[model samples]
Target: MEILRLDSFSFRYPHTQRCALKDITLSADEGDFVLLCGASGSGKSTLLENLKPELRRNGERTGEITCLGRPLQSLSRMESACDIGFVMQNLEAQLVADTVRGELCFGLESLGFPPEVIRRRVAEMASYFGLGKLLNRSVNTLSGGEKQLVSLASVLSLSPKLLLLDEPASQLDPVAARELFSMLARINSELGITILLAEHHTEELFTLCSKAVLLHNGQVSFCGAPREAARFITQNRTLSSDAIPPQTKESGSAYVFTSLLPSAAKIFPDEPSLPLSVREGRALFKQKISGRTPPAPMPVIPPTAPPAVSVTDVYFGYGSKDTLLFHDLSLTLYEGELSAVMGANGSGKSTLLKLLCGLLKPKRGTIELFGKRGAKPTLGYLPQNPRLLFLADTVQQDLTACAENLRLLHPEERIQSLSEALGISDILSSHPYDISAGELQRAALAKVLLSSPRLLLLDEPTKALDPFAKSKLAALLRGLVQSGVTVLFASHDTEFCASYCDRCALLFDGQTAATGAPAQFFGGNVFYSTAAARIAAGFSYDSVTCGEVRNLWIK
Candidate 1:
């Protein structure tokens, strides 16, 4: 049975000349897991909103949408609410109640379910989503990942047949994200619910999803099996090629899927089969290197230079001393270097960033700048939610306002330079609220960079960006570091931190548990490592990237 279908769907937001979604025709059969992919502003989110009538944005729309063989427009309010469940990218935006139990009950109660039925369904959902321990916990106290899980559980309590998820795991750590995907797979397989997901994090999902819908310039570019989509994408050499798995990118072979990249490295380009997961990749590697010698140990970076930002015996918390988050924590960031902080959700990564950026004060500690006494460095901070940084209607207005506030003599030139560098020149006139999440992040970063801060802090900067955009951001941050700006960012992207950052720090139990170069930092971690690192374990020492492993084996 066809669970959902769209015919020649075209939509344009109010006051916009171009269509956000142009003639998009797509469909999903019952029990299908469809992944919707595109570059920033390519209309993935807009198309998702169109699928759920209640969530659709006010726009000029022309299309025919069908759900469960009935016209979507003709479905009654109760039917729509009970059949389609939509989970947003921003978890906080969807949460309404104060506690976990309350949030789970809100949806069921709203739909006029009996009290006993609502209670039973809420308990089942909490157990299914692992929210039982947090039933009485305040929603505000939950971590980003926990909040997202709760939001998902709440939607599931309504017992919808079809689920629409928009960048659902953009805020979660790698472990949490993998768990969420696994849960989604189970839901599709056991419950027979149709799932349509719009997301940028494609690494693990490529193997999990049955089909993919690739959108570009507000149109359906390709819609097919995951493997076929990977081949087509690689052959075309589009900027979205980064969305292909790292191994697939390395092989440059349209014949193989991205999921098999790790195992592809262990074999020649002419190999008949490639492994998609680490277990298979490791088996392939064992066959290739039966008696090979392991590579020599790599040198570690020594911390000899003076620190740029230093914290000594920091003790901080939200309110009272009993609620401490950072307990006697100490850290150091060197000048002209990019450092990445990683940890489990709610491990105080964001709190550390806030303290470093002067958004909060330490209860009993000292944070010194530039290794100088009583000195404060000019700072720039980009919060996890970039929308908080925007105050104006349009991107142009926000940038212009920032420049004016900073008293730049040539504000126009600065705005143009940032606009071009961030690849957001086209959306300069668009309202900040109307742009895509990736575009908004870049816009906010541009707004912060206008002041020319020496020390920069970013919280989950790559949360919603495509792989190409992430690469661009890495290069941009490297350039900034080379230009004498020090950067400290909190991220859950292990591959990104291992590949791009100069150093990686693990924040655990209110302190810096481990800190070292990316190679050493990730090499020591067991579960927290990347796919490349896991696959290349036997052949190379401290090789945490596919490129590193490939270069050594090719010789």
Candidate 2:
């Protein structure tokens, strides 16, 4: 049964000239799992907002919406609120309480549930969501994954029939994202809850979703079964192709996607039953490449580039000596190199960036730039949440604000040139919050580049960007490196590092555990490796990307 529907819906936000969503028609059946796919600014978030009446934007609308066999307008506010649950892209924005138990009870309390009922529901939710251990813990202390889980569990406590997720895993690491998706899959299967999930990462989701709707510039480009949608996306590269699997793109003749890429390397488009897991992929690999002898792994030579930033015997922390994060940790970042710093949450990766940026002073250590002592070179730093840097109402205003503080290389033309360079000139008048995360990222980057820094530092720079945006960012960083700027970013995106970074360093236990080329870094580890590396194992060393593996296999 159709639980909700939209017909020829169009919307334009206040103070905006362009429509955010246009002639969008879609539906979600009871117990259906719909995957919403799109580029950064393709109207996925706007569509999800329209489904929940309370969260709808203040805009001009022209269309009809029906919910549970009734006109959406005819439903009461309470009815609309109780039937649909919306989870925003920013995890912290949705959290309202101090503790896990308090968060779970906040909604129930607001709904006027008795203390007894609220208590019963909170206990049930805590146990079911595996948040029992964290019930008494402060919500602020939890990791990105934990916070998202609490947000979902808190929303589910109300027993809403429909769940709307907006890039729920955008801020999490790969392992955390996998776990969240697995839980969502279980929720769809066991509880029969209808789900409409908007996401940029679709590799693991393709196997779990029943239907998919691809949005392009606020219009439905493709709406069909998940597998068919994969085929459609493969043929139409312009339609947010970042969500397309790496293994699928590696197929030279035809686009192919199998959850088990190790076993099924590649398959023809005509192959109907694509393997959906590692086991299935392995079985398929045995059937195809049974007796072929695999190639030997290559050795990685250490980089000999001149040092750009050098750290020596650094001992630093926030509060006291006992709280030291980096103790005698020494490392050197090379000039004209794109280096990635990676580690688990709370492993001091971000602290390292702060130390390099001069935001945090080391208690006992010396940092040198270009072999010069006590010299502070021009630098740009983008924190984990770049949005925090936004201070003005509009993108242009924010850029202008940044211009006032910049040590401009070109003093005559200020924000205009930088805005154009970042491709945000078109949305200069729009509010920063109104833009997509990817656009905001570019805007933030433009603001940072105002000073023309010789060195750049980014923390989780790709947290909310899709693959297409990531490619653009990678290219942009590469251009900066070519221009003699040293680039270093802290990230959990292993695939991106393997594909783009010149070097990768694993930060752990107050020191650099390993530092080497992408091939050597990923090829040495099993669990902390990229999907392409795992799939191409035994095929060739130094093959961290699907394209590289494909070329080697073809040879």
**Over the stretch 1-555, how does candidate 2's per-residue lDDT look in tens digits?**
998899999999998788889999989899999998876777889888888888887999999988888998888867766677888898879999999888999888888888998889899888888999999998987888899999999888888889999999887777788899999999998988899999876757877889988776788877888767756545533212122343333343122222112222232222356544445543554455556777666666766888988889988876666887788888888998999998876778888898888888888989887787677798889988878889899988877767776645554376776665566777888888888887888888878877878989998888767665677678788988999899999998887899899988887788888988998899887766776566556654576665554444344
The top-ranked prediction according to TM-score is 1
Q: Report the C-alpha lDDT of model 1 over 1-555, residue by residue, as the tens digit.
A: 888999998999998899999998989999999998877788889888888889888989898888989999998898888889999988889999999999999988888899999989988998888889999999999987789888988888888889999999889998889888899999999899899998876767777899988877788878898766755655543222222333333444331223222223323222344344567666766676667778888987587757988889999888676988899999887988899999999999998998887788889999888887457678899999999988888999989988999999999998998888787898999898889999999999999899989999999998888765677688889989999899999999897898799988898889999998989888888878887778777667597876665555555
Please report how far candidate 2 places residue 387 from its true position, in Å.
2.3
Q: RMSD of candidate 1 to the true fold?
A: 3.4
- Candidate 1's C-alpha runs over 4 A off are 238-274, 288-290
TM-score of 1: 0.93
Estimate the lDDT of model 2. Answer: 0.77
Which candidate number has the best lDDT?
1
Ten consecutive residues with minimal summed lDDT in candidate 2?
253-262
| Model 2 clash tally, residue pairs | 3
* RMSD in order of candidates: 3.4, 4.2
